[model samples]
Target: MIRVIVCDDQTLVRTGFVTILDAQPDIEVVGEAGDGLAVVELARRVRPDVVVMDIRMPGLDGIEATRRLAGPGVAEPVRTLVVTTFNLDEYVYEALRAGASGFLLKDATPQQLIAGVRTVAAGDALLAPAVTRRLIGRYGSRVRAADPPGAAGGGGANRSGLAPRELEVLRLIAAGQSNAEIAAALVLSGETVKTYVSRILAKLGLRDRVQAVVYAYRNGLADEMGEY
Candidate 1:
């Protein structure tokens, strides 16, 4: 079973999520918190496989909570999935940067929410299609501008130590290509593509493909203006 913790300030919203997630046989709602401050202790105690976090709470807030739970300095970071009612670009970007594996709109369907939790619990990133496009579009230019010269052209030593093929996989990931699509494009098997993706994430020290996408954009490996 995939252990999970749900955190949200609103009682109705928290209960609704718990209700849907608890019904999944493969998932269990082990703990719940109504404030960000309480969540930190709950997470440490429960050590859940995934955390369904709300962006806004009375204290601490989800972003900071995510940072504490999954940030770079964390020794045993937990995977986090941020759920918010607002689709603000800064919130999405900051959540990811804070080490959240993914984000979903609170209005997402029950199936989507379930799928998202499972995805993150299975160690993959989950971003809504529209959220992905909008995030890339709004933040692409900033990422491109932040890159140093010769970084995108592969002229510099691959910072993440990825090989040529692995770099290609990372780019396709940023382009929002699925494993099957990447496999077809590269004339490789699905398992092979999955392996490549795993290696890429491992080498880059990223939590999942969503962080890989962020890494690609920030490092200029992906075209800022390109449609994903």
Candidate 2:
């Protein structure tokens, strides 16, 4: 089973998420928290496979909680998917930089919510390509000058480690292409594309495609690739 911890400031929000998650036989809601501090305690206790986090909690907040649970400093961080009611571009960027595995609107349909959990639980990312492009372009442009020489504002390390084909895969990832789509675009098999994607993640030390998308945009790689 894919164990999950749902954290939100509102009791109803937590209960609602638990309800949706519990219906999935593959997913189990091991715990719930009404605030960020409680989230940490519950997560440590449950050791869930994924965390559905809310950003505007009363204390600590989702971003910091995400960092503590999944950021670069953690030795064995858990995956966190940000599920928030707000659509602030800045919050989205911060959550990703703090090591959130994905983002989703709180009002997302039950299917979307379930998909987000499974995606993160499987160690993939949940942010769609268009949303990634929009969020990164919106937030990244404002801080381009302040960003590292080639670093994305999302705090992804330099991506020089990526191989040429891996870079191609990364570009397509930012364009919102699935493994099959990328395979078709590059004339490679879907399985091959999947392998390249795995290599891309390992070499970049990234958690999932969301960060890869963020990396591509922050470094201008996505723009050069054009749309697929």
Candidate 3:
């Protein structure tokens, strides 16, 4: 079974998500938390496969909770799926950076919700490519001094030792293309695209597609990657 812990500040919303998830035979709702702190503690105690997190809680907000549970250098990072009511939530990108495995809007249908849980449980990201592009383009920046370092704001791809074809694949991945889409665009087999993605992640020390997107933006590859 895919064990999950649902965390939300609103009691009704929390119960609804619990009901929807627990109803799935392949999924089990192991716990529910009304705030970020509670969810963090519950998750540590239970060690669930996935945590359905809400953004605005009374204390410790979901972003921080996600970081604590899944951020870089974590001993054992549990997958987190962040669910929010807003479609253009500002916190979504930060949540991804904090190591959320997937994202879904609260307005999503029950089927989509179930699918998202399964996808995250299976260790696949759940963000739409278009949505990923839009979010990263809007909030992702290489010139921001307060964030981190290593982005000279315009170049860095040549140093990764990626070949021309691999660089093309990296650009597509940063632009939010799936393996199938990348294959279709590059006229390669889907399996080949998967191999390229794996290589990119291994080379760059990235965790998943989400991190690749962030890396592209941070390293100024976003400027060269054309639309979709």
Candidate 4:
């Protein structure tokens, strides 16, 4: 079973998410929290496979919670899926940069919510939708906002580390191509594409697809508009 914890400041919204997820045979709502502090503590105790987080919580924000759970240098990173009220909310991008595996608008359908949890639990990112790519673009500049002066563009050593085919896969990933679509585009099997993606991410030291997209944009491997 995919154990999950639901974290939100709103009682009604939290309960609704718990209800929908618990109804799935393969998913269980192991814990629920009304704020970021409570969620972070609960997650430490539960070690859930996925944490469904809310952005606007009191006492602490979801972005920081995600950073604590999954950010770089974490001893044991928990997979986080952030749910927010607005697709264009800048905080959502911050949460992603903080190491969230994915984000969904709170109004997302129950099926989408369930899928988001499963996607994260299964170790696949939930940011493949083209619309999500646009959200990334809106803040793509922030990824490189602090770059050193004269930093060369276009992935430099990052591109050099990848084999030609792996480099192609990385570009496609930044372009928002799902594994299945990439497989078709390259006339390869889905498993093969998945393998290539894994290799590319490992080579680039990206935590997930969201970071991969950000890294691509930061290094000019992909354009801000998600075009390769």
Candidate 5:
């Protein structure tokens, strides 16, 4: 079973999410928190496979909670799925930067929410390429200039330890291309594109494709003007 912890300031929202999630035979709501501060402790205690977090809780916001649970220095990161009523690009970008594996609007259908939790629990990013592209295009420019892509290598693709072909694949991924699309664009097999994606993520120390997209945009590897 996929263990999950639900965190939201509103009791109704928390209950609603739990109800929807618990009905799934493959999922279980092991814990729930109405405050961000408590959610961290709950997560640590439960060690859930996925966390459904809300953004505006009192005490500590979901972004910080996410950072604590899944950020860079974490020895055992838990996958987080950010769910909020607001669809602001800044929130989406920040949540991903804080190590959330996925972001979803609160109005998302029950099926979508269930799918998102399962996807994150299964170690995949719950992002649609088209939606991710839009979010990045709107907020990517706000990223600091000092943090260019390949900052480790003075803004070179080598910083992520990706080969030329892998770099190309990553660029396409940043452009919101699916594996099949990337394969067709590069005239390679689907399996080959998948392999490149895995290699890129492994070398970059990234959690999933969402993080890859964020990294590409933050580092200037992907541009708003780039054709998809």
Candidate 6:
């Protein structure tokens, strides 16, 4: 079973999500939290496979909660999905940067919500095309953004460390292609695409596909390589 924790400030929202997820035989709502503090406590105690978080919670907020659970310094990071009523560009960008594996609208369909959990659990990202484009355009244009081509710095080492094929996969991922879609597009098996994606994430030191897509757009890989 895929154990999950639902975190939101609103009681109705939390209850609704729990009801929807508990209906799935393979998924269980092991715990629920009404705010960020409760979420941290429940997460440490439960160690759920996935956390459906709300970005606008009182206290710590989803971004910091995600960082604590899944950011670079965590000893054992848990995968988190930010499910919020607002799709603000800044919220999405910050959440992804803080190590969230996926983002979804609170009004997302039952199927979409379930798929978001499963996708992140399977080490995949869930960046809808509109969200991807919005975040890329918003954060990419910010001042002091790192230079994509020379992002690795003085060593000329191409610090991204991705090979040509892996680069292709990253571009496709940023363009919002799933493993199956990428496989069909590149004329490879889904397994092969998965392998390439894994390598790309490892090479880039990215936590998941969301970060890879962020990197791709930030560094101009998406623009040069074009869309999915």
- Residue 102 local lDDT, model 3: 70
Quantify how close model 2 is to the true structure by its C-alpha RMSD in Å.
3.1
Over the stretch 1-228, how does candidate 6's per-residue lDDT look in tens digits?
Answer: 899999998899889899999999989999999887888889999999999999988889988999888876688889999986554778777788788988998779999999989988877778876567766656754523353321344212443477777878888888777788899888899899979987776666666788777777766667677544
RMSD of each: 3.8, 3.1, 2.9, 3.4, 2.4, 2.9
- Candidate 3 local lDDT, 1-228, one digit each (tens): 999999999999999999999999999999999888898899999999999999888879999999999988789998999997556556888888788887888888999999999999988787767577777767777335234221223335333567778878888887777788899999999999889888877776667777777777766676677654
Predicted candidate 4, C-alpha RMSD: 3.4
lDDT (0 to 1) per candidate:
0.81, 0.80, 0.81, 0.81, 0.83, 0.79
- Candidate 5's C-alpha runs over 4 A off are 148-154, 157-161, 224-228
Off by over 4 Å in 3: 142-159
Go through the candidates in order and give the clash count of each.
0, 0, 0, 0, 2, 1
Deviation from native of the Cα of residue 194 in model 1, angstroms:
1.1
Most accurate candidate by lDDT: 5
Give the residue spans of candidate 2 off by over 4 A: 142-161
- lDDT per residue as tens, model 1, 1-228: 999999999999999999999999999999999998899999999899999999878879899999999987789999999997555677777778788998999889999999999999988888765567567546754744343222233423445488978888888887777898889888899999999998877766566887777777777777633333
| Residue pairs with backbone overlap in model 5 | 148-219, 149-219
lDDT of 2 by residue, 128-188 (tens): 6556677766775555533532133433345666777788898888876789888998899
Off by over 4 Å in 4: 145-155, 224-228
